[model samples]
Target: MSALSLYALFTGRKPPSVKYKYYRKYFIIYAASMSSFAVHTVFICFFYVINIPILSVINVFSVSVWALALRENYYGRHSNAIFLACAEISIHAVLATAYLGWSSGFQFYLWPAACLATINPRLGVRLSSAIGFGCIVLFILLKTVVDDGLYNFDFRKYADFFYVFNGIIAGISLIFGICSIRVINERQEEKLTDLATKDELTNLFNRRYINSYLSEYEPDADLENRPYCIVLGDLDYFKKVNDTLGHYAGDDVLIDVSRYLKQRFRSSDVVCRWGGEEFLFLLKDTSLRQAHDLVEKICRDIPDNIHVCSSQRIRITMSFGIAASTGVSQHEQLIKVADENLYQAKKQGRNCVVSSEITG
Candidate 1:
């Protein structure tokens, strides 16, 4: 519907899609209503009563064309838009039918033109309606009132009412579009802010963000089991791949590693980029053993895909250290113990998980 509105507003220009759907049907119906008013009203003075046979044919044809456009506009359809469109169509259909009876459907087409005001909360709808309504009024005066050359339009006596009606339509489109644009812009900003805190390379929370969040997280000292476990893992000899293949290949390694962690861990587990060549996982509501074992599984599963250096299948491994939040006063305290264990894992042999609980 937005696309249709955008196109109509731009006089048949194409619009970009955040997502695509057909509200074009509604827009086309709207345009048809306005355009039809122009066509139908021109003849109202001659007949004073619409040709029902012709109107029936035109209405039926209009409905069919709208259905086709409706289907296409549905590519990005929302239920709300559908409901609104249906309501607008129903109202316009009834009014159009009545206009046919009075042979003045064109004169009243302004009513349906005003319906565009409801298309959105933007001021544009109301503005368009006003423009259209003004056109209708001018159409009425030029053809009917000025006929005797006395500058006497029949509706000139009630021009105030018509002007007010146009003003209302203008206000409606403007408010709706403004509100909708503001909300859409706000959402886009929020998504952008969220992206800023993420690691584009690994699709994980960046270490800076993790640290900031951790700094804000208050620990519970009285709990028997820890609230969470922090695991630090470093890829063993990661520099060798970069040194051999290139930075691009090294990026793939990081991506694969991140995916491996995400696949194995629960949704609640948070994986973060813990500086270059290292990663961190915060497992919520986990014990020391569970944390250590989980990290061990992740360390073991790092894919050594053939794409590493020579486009040949290769294996990759990392060493992990685990520490529970239990008895840890600060976020760094937990990381400190985890780092110690990680160093121990590296010393024992690469590609293993080391835990202080197991060492002593």
Candidate 2:
């Protein structure tokens, strides 16, 4: 299970993600796993009159507390692995020490640890390997010195089988899990990259993302291969609404406009919040004329009515500018030209589209 799960992580899926809707399910898993720990601890207590190995039972309790804390309201990309690792720790602490059955509770030990290793292969390998080795050491020492009949030949026959099982599980998980870390890290890095480039409010790729995306767009072809046009847009009279109503109203307007652009454009295009009341778009494989038409459509379709503090309806408009970069110069040049044209649109009518003439 450990080996298969780790390998599946490499190509099967993009790791587990924590979403708000699944909050209840996460709690359920945590409860079940913690209950497993409690049950294991309880079962072990029956052997020595509820007094057999209280130390491990206590550790299980502590680990359960840690599990609850880690799995609480704190949801992230890697929280599942962390929770599973904690669960494994609790299970093993009880099984290895309390049950003293290396073959029983520890049977599925590799599964949870494997989950950790799968989610973060590199860190999982390094971390779980050390943990695995520690378990082995503890297993050998405790079995030989304490449980081996205090220097007598007792349960000695179980040593080889237990050691072999632990060795194989630990060795395989560490080896393969480490190998897949680079890939997992790459995916995580992509998500972080998306966050940095996307606007939190509207979820449109930001100017920064558009800039970097173009900068690293081509490896062999210089700036000449991008074939992208830029459109700069500014919300006209946006400040008046904020001053007249409130910033909340202005924010709602901005959200509405952003949604308009996102739904109106093609999937290949990127829309960005350039700044306060200003936005930019990267229209892939498009020309200046096409960009102009697109912006014109948005200008004509934008709703003018926005509700106010006293339930009064208000109207709004936007101005846009267009410029094309034929993958020949810096991407910023197109944006600058677009900005100039956007200003021209505002100057012309405050609710129109203007295309900037290419220079040089």
Candidate 3:
């Protein structure tokens, strides 16, 4: 399996994953630093065998990055931690290349730094690009100006081995970092989708989703005469609750009513918080009689009182109007028809269900 796929599988699907941008970035950088610490510790053993003291010093710098990651995590200053990590990696790359000669393959470290700086949305593209350019310039200058006398070990003797090793590590780091970016992007997309489709107050499907669903949903005409029904529901005396107990209590009532309505409807049914103190449902593959029966069941099942703040129990009721599309192609007309039935229900008396086919 590819490194990205393996890493994803190893991590598994963590639902409702870390959503905070700063915290997510912090986690990625912390993980990178920890991995660096492990890799550098392994290199420390290799350097000890070769008696390369400067390379040992570079490994110490990697340890320092780990320490800084811990400190930044403690302080909850995650952005600074990422910046410091990028700087740490860059400096280690420059110094290692300068002291051990470019053949030590230290220049490969710059790729991860560039990847981190580029992918992190918090960091500016132009600024990271400039930093990457500087690293490239620094590497070239080190190769040009640094003499062989400064080098402790001649890595050129095992250049192919060192090159392959460095390439594998660099490739792994780049792949892991890119996968992390993709994970964050996916989380953000999920979050945005929720915000766009969900009602802020009731946490039910909002008017936007309902409107979109109505426009897109096409049922098979051969199944039945009327394949769907739209039920319009409004809380009876909702304004009185708001005026008497305050809007907060009214909000509580709406949320409670939403829960009750959700339980009454089937999973295939589309239930939405249509507006303030109002809800809408689209019952799929339901006849007008079935729709009316479902709406009546909901009206009867909904509790008469909702307990809100300060243990104050407030009484409320809902009025329902249901209309089914009878061989009619237009869904918009069903909504209008349902709304009119709802008005008729209120006119007759609140806390009742009205349907054009059943009531009229």
Winning model by TM-score: 3
The residue-by-residue lDDT of candidate 2 on 1-360, one tens digit each, is: 266444433332222444654444344344344454455455445433534354345455645654454444133324553545544553554345334444332443454454453353335567766665555555465444544232213334555765576566556645654555555567679879878988877777787777787666532233455456778889888888898888887888788888877888898887889988998887787777777787787888785433334466566788888887654656667677888888888889788988865644
Sliding window of 10 residues with minimal summed lDDT for model 2:
147-156
> What would the TM-score be for candidate 3 when compared with the true structure?
0.76
Can you write out model 1's per-residue Cα lDDT over 133-203, one digit (the tens) per residue?
Answer: 55456446534643333221333443455445444543554465356546666877877877978888887
State TM-scores per candidate.
Answer: 0.55, 0.62, 0.76
Indicate the worst ten consecutive residues by lDDT in candidate 1.
97-106
lDDT string for model 3 (1-360, tens) is: 456543532342221232455566656665676676677787777776778866787887777776676456434565666677778888877777677666667678788887666654457889877876776677677778873426745555765676577768877887887888899789999989999999988889999899988886744542355468889999888888898888887787788888878877899888999988889998988988988887887787665444555445555778999887766556677788899999999998888999974221
lDDT on C-alpha atoms for all candidate structures = 0.58, 0.61, 0.74
lDDT score, residue 311, model 2?
60
Per lDDT, the best of the predicted structures is 3
Q: State the displacement of the C-alpha of residue 333, model 1, in Å, after optimal TM-score superposition.
A: 1.3
Clashing pairs in 2: 223-327, 224-327, 304-315
